[model samples]
Target: MQSSSELFPVALMSAELRGDLTEDVYRLKPANSPDPSVELVLTRLGRFGQEGGRGVPVILLHGSFSNRRFWYSPRGLGLAPYLARAGFDPWIAEMRGHGLSPRNQQYRRNRVADYARYDLPAIAAFVREQSGQVPHWIGHSLGGTTLAAALGGHYLGEEDVASAALFGSQVSRNYWPLKVPPVEWGGRMLLKRFEVLSGSWLKRGPEDEPIGLALESLRWHGLFGRFGDAERDWWAGLAEVRMPVMAVAAAGDLQDPAWACRKLLEQVPEEHRHFLLLAKDEGFSDDFGHIEMLVSKAAEREVWPLVAHWLEHQRLPLTTAALEAVAL
Candidate 1:
């Protein structure tokens, strides 16, 4: 591994106030990335007067077909800002070709493998250098899955992460059709026709995704499949993860259901593993969907505070009605 300065040359893009909060954007160019031209954009939100998030660094990653905006809006009304207001230094990262991040040389070949192996380490190192404290990571949907891959593959360690919290993320959902050779072959062949999956056309979100990601999923759910690459078995690695972690799922999250999310949580094999299911039965008025669990007004009241509390204290209480095992 290279030093943070040698590996990631950063450019300060902007430092301005969004509402009452200060937003500083930086573009990091890493020399060791598989795709050499890759540039990742990180946005850190802070208060007008506070310094260095009071030594509590938080890194937030968005799901597929989304960007940093998923965690925050330009008007500064989102989880990132909410965390900032609560005296936590929150960094929001955009994936390749999403939001402020520009396309790399092999834009179409970008996969979670590349992100876990090449991108996340640099991001973690950069955050560590900028803030003297190890940061806690938070991810939504694909972001959470990528975080799992990074941790399971040993791309990150206890030195880099204080803890991790995943929202609306899971890998247990089975695509039975992909289990057959013929169906998997046909699906790959059809997906190869396009360089990217159009989020706009699919009405999934605001950004497009490399088809390599789609193809990668086929392999994961295919025959003899596991959640890992050729180099490491991420599923097996999950049991080896030592840091505190949490996985939250929504009852109405059809994309990544509560049952599937719980499966991911169960794999960690940690004594402090926390599982939260946002459902009407859990005291939330709504059985929040995949997107709603993070980006809705309901989440602002019920979910954001829990995240803050989790970062402050490692274990959640086992008695909260709104959370599976919520708050300190």
Candidate 2:
């Protein structure tokens, strides 16, 4: 592994104040990755009062066809800002070809494997260097799935993560037909015809997805396929993850249902792991959908506070001895 400065040359793009929150944006390029064009954009948000304290660093990963905006709006409203207002240093990352990130030279060939092996570790290294501490991670949907891949494959170790919280993410919603050889081949052939999936047209979100991502997912769900990459079995590898984990699901999420999310959570052998289902039965007024579970106004009142509490639990307590040590 290379030093953070060597592996990722960062460009501090801009900094501005959003109401009382300060937002700083940085672009990080993996100088060592085979794909030279790949670059990731990370946005850091902190409150004016919390600057010197440097609150517990938290990174938020957005789902597919979305960007940093998913965690925050132009007006500084959303979970990222919410966390910052509560004295958490929140960082939002945009994956390749999404939001502020530029498309890699092999953008069309980008896959979750690439993200797990190359992009994530670079992000972790950069964050650790900047913060002087391991950061907790939170992801939604495909973002969460990629986080799972990184953890399951051991791309990230316990030292890299304080904890992980995944929202509406899973790999267990199996499609049986894709398991068949002929069906798999046909699907791949059809998908290969397109270079990217139009998120705006598909009504999924604002950003388009590279066709390579679709193909990679098909291969995983295919009959002979498994969750891991070339080196390890990701599903089996989950049991080895030692960090405290949380998996959240929305009852009305037809895309990735609660049961499927639970199945993914169940695979993790960590005793500290937990699952939360956002359903009417769970006291939420409605069975929250995939997006609603995180973005709705309801989330502002209920979900965001839960997330803040969870992050607080994982943070290292600041004892007087520790403060004195810092002074020395």
Candidate 3:
């Protein structure tokens, strides 16, 4: 494994769409897009296993208010390289409004729900066109939630995805009562009022902060944390996903309680569903919060391997009876 500093140079080398990037990284425009065309800013590690062929493509989705850069950050608990080593082509997606995705200069009024309908579907279409198959969807936090919505038929075209691995995602509409500080609650109210006054044309903030810092700020004062009527309608659609799902929860993740995670897993129609919780010693204890499982150093060693192993297992051909037996 490379040191965090070593990884920083690689991450810095990747282009930021309009921003300047270091020498080691170069940006490439993805093929077969009808729109303005998406740019895949990536770092090519050596080929995965033997044969050196392009591996199974996997698209990673980051949590709320975070960009694709979270997957490559030094402290990031990303599984891209590890997946690549395990014979998978790792692709990180920046949702339409979040990362290096082109800003909507046209319809300026965009909301978090728009991501489920637009950005994620666009990414899925792009992946299918380029990779020739529906890639496995891996996401954390709000990213996972949006992906769930997309898989459940909220997105257009209804692509047949292979499977999904969701981390620290919530399925119920009961997230608001989770005991936030008074100041944070006040900040959230202010942001909600601001969004209403602005007609949902609120601009996104900078993207260089730590994942925790970004989500904390959103939790305190951004539309990302506010779940309204639209969000409730969105969650209602998650019951449509019928594919096998690997739902993960960290024992210490207060943002996604274990009970809630189990409840969410029960909603998956797949008999091959599995739920796993990160142990406290894995730094998933009280210190590592919601988004940390994807960006924290501890996740690289602990959480990611479990995700990779589960993905590998799902790729195997199993009869319905065998799968049900395993689920049992």
What's the CA error at residue 131 for candidate 1, in Å?
0.6
Listed per model in order, the count of residue pairs whose N, CA or C atoms clash below 3 Å is 0, 1, 1
Model 2: lDDT equals: 0.86
lDDT of 1 by residue, 120-219 (tens): 8889989888887899999999999999999999999999999999899999998888899999999999999999999999999999999999999988
lDDT for model 3, on a 0 to 1 scale? 0.55
Query: What lDDT does the true structure give each of the candidates?
Result: 0.88, 0.86, 0.55
Clashing pairs in 1: none
- Alpha-carbon runs more than 4 Å astray in model 2: 1-7, 314-328
Best by TM-score: 1
Candidate 3, 44-126: lDDT as tens digits: 33242342476666878877556766665543224775676567767777654445554433223444445565556655655
Rank candidates by lDDT, best first: 1, 2, 3
